[model samples]
Target: MAAPGFLEADGRNMSRATVLMLMAPFFALVIFAFLYPLANLLSISVLEPQPTLEHYQRVAENPVYARVLFRTLQIALLVSLLSLALSLPVAVLMANSRGPKAIFLTACILLPFWSSVLVRTAAWAILLQRNGIINQTLQFIGITDEPVRLLYTQGAVVVAMTHVLMPFMVLPIYGALRNIPADYSRAAAICGAGPLRTFWEVTLPLAMPGIIGGFILVFLTALGYFITPALLGSPQEMMIATLISQQMRENLDWPFAAALVGVLTLIVTVITLAFSKVFRFERMLGGRV
Candidate 1:
């Protein structure tokens, strides 16, 4: 009854419209639940009562806040470097191994992730305290006349965070290493390259992408870490998250707290974008994805 092909075309158009309608709720939910809340939080940095940049100015002007920010960066840098250093050999071994050895190594990397962060932090607190296992062992062996102060230190926070985050570094690097073709290394050897030379010239460059990705991931997480530092370190070692929490809950300063979060978010966003731009080589880094 309709014009030639017109009815079929109309039917196709109607189907497309129906599909779009079905997808609308999902889009709405994403905007409302995630994007909207993030936008609101960011707004707090500049928008209070009316709108002003005073909050950001205060953060920049305050020596204490500035010092904390620097400390945050320092801790993040150390954690990222340490995590990379520790993860590489483990990743290499995991990539090379098979059967039970591979399974055991992988399990070790994943075991800590099975436990809650709070539980891990608490465990460290007990183990690192003055009367804790390490101190007691030292005292028993006559290493010290008294239990040394191992807990409530920056070193303690760094150690706990490194232990907690080592897996993140390992998995990415391991995936990358495993994705590398064995033939490349074999070819290098056939070309009369020594073991160290082949690895340095071939494997290391290829593995760089994974290394950088893992570095960024560890750094970002360490930047935002709260529980380990809070539990293991003194007040002076407080990180940004702890500071934000103190401002919001203890001081009842939502705007300032939100501003702190906003600043941290900005720093992370900038770093991530920059890293992505500079390290498009991540795809070449093997299986880091």
Candidate 2:
């Protein structure tokens, strides 16, 4: 018979092999669906037209591309901040409430997801139009002599994007807050900590993981947003996504577009790595790193 130690090691190896076998299909799908397309994009950026780096050079040289990229980053960051600020209170409410209140809050957050993004964006456009409900209300309340230019502006783009992405921020935060035991807060209170002090010292730190995760989700989504920005923003407010769309459709410059995508991909990868390092995400998720 095999030794006990050897038998246990063999069993562990078999389990590992079985797990890998089970995951093989998922790995294959990810490779074909995501990695293959991404590799093709990178190859096109340099390898097309006799392996020239002109597309990347052009992107580096062009101030216009830089401006669009900066604007995209700015908007994405702004949306993430706004979503975090708005989500905190709502998530807290959802976590603290019971029964009908929690259910209602959850339903409200989820209701928007049931509707299409285009429809939600269109609703914003209608509300923000020169003579639309918001402007009309402003005029009625004597806040302005004329209709304000709320639509086709950077603010409108930001606002609409924040509305659409708020759920992503809220849900993760709610999960984190919900997971926190009530006894933790009670323990803090018993230790002579006021509500504010308890929250500041205990709650916020514990919720950092969810906050970071939500911010990442919102920021990344905003980075590639197309419809809301296109519908609500002017040419001056064009983002990197709009620039890419323009290159692909109107300019028909596939190589240049691929270069743009490669740059964005690089930035995203860098940011993700930086956040992972700085935040120690595994620790946040209660894992040993």
Candidate 3:
């Protein structure tokens, strides 16, 4: 008979091989679909036109590109913060409620997802236009003498983006809040802590993982956001994605557009790394280390 140790080793090897075989299709898809396209983008950015760095140099030197990049970061941060603020109360409500109340709240939150993003944005345009419902309501209420220029402004872009992204923030936070044992809060109350104090001290810290995850999700999605900003914002309010689209389509500057993409990709990589280092992402996603 084979030695027990040798038999155990052989079984382990077979298990490892089976796992790898199961994962082969996923790895192949990632390589061809994602890594290959990214490699092409990086190559075109620097290797096109005889290995020149002038494309990147122009992006660095140009004031327009810098402004747009800064604006994109600003808008993304704003949207993330706004989404967090709006989501917290709703998440709390959902976490604490049960039965029909929970169902109703969930339905309200999910109602927006049934529609396309373009349709949602167009709805905002109708509500914010000069003679639209919002302006008319304000006029009827005597808040303003005439129609306000609500559409095609930075505020409009921020508001619409916040509304669109709020669901992403709410769901993560709700999950986090729901996972906390009811005993913890009861323990706090027994320890003479008021409701507000118990929530601030016990509840918030436990729910932080969800909050961070939500913030990162909203911020990253907003960074590459195109349609909402494009429709609602003016030329002066253009974000980096819009600039990249203009460069690619209107100017037909493929290499330059690739360089712009390279810059944005670098920024995203840096931000993701920084967040990972500062927080335990495994915990944030409710996984054990």
Q: Give Cα-based local distance difference scores for all models.
A: 0.85, 0.89, 0.91
Model 1: colliding residue pairs:
none
Candidate 2: worst-modelled 10 consecutive residues by lDDT? 280-289
For 1-289, candidate 2 gives per-residue lDDT tens digits of 5334433454544454556777999999999999999999889999988699999999999998999999999999999999999999999899899999988999999999999999999999999998899999999999999998999999999999999999999987888887778888999999999999988999888888888888987888899899999999999879999999999999999999999999999999998888888876654442221
Worst 10 residues of 1 by lDDT: 5-14
| Clash statistics: count for each candidate | 0, 0, 0
Tens digit of lDDT per residue, candidate 3, span 1-289? Answer: 6334443455544454556777999999999999899889889989888799999999999998899999999999999999999999999999999999999999999999999999999999999999999999999999999998999999999999999999999988888999999999999999999989999999889999899989998999999999999999998889989998998899999899999999999999999999999888866663322
Q: Evaluate model 2: give its TM-score.
A: 0.91
The C-alpha stretches of model 3 lying farther than 4 A from their native spots are 1-22, 286-289
Candidate 1, residue 109: CA error in Å? 0.8
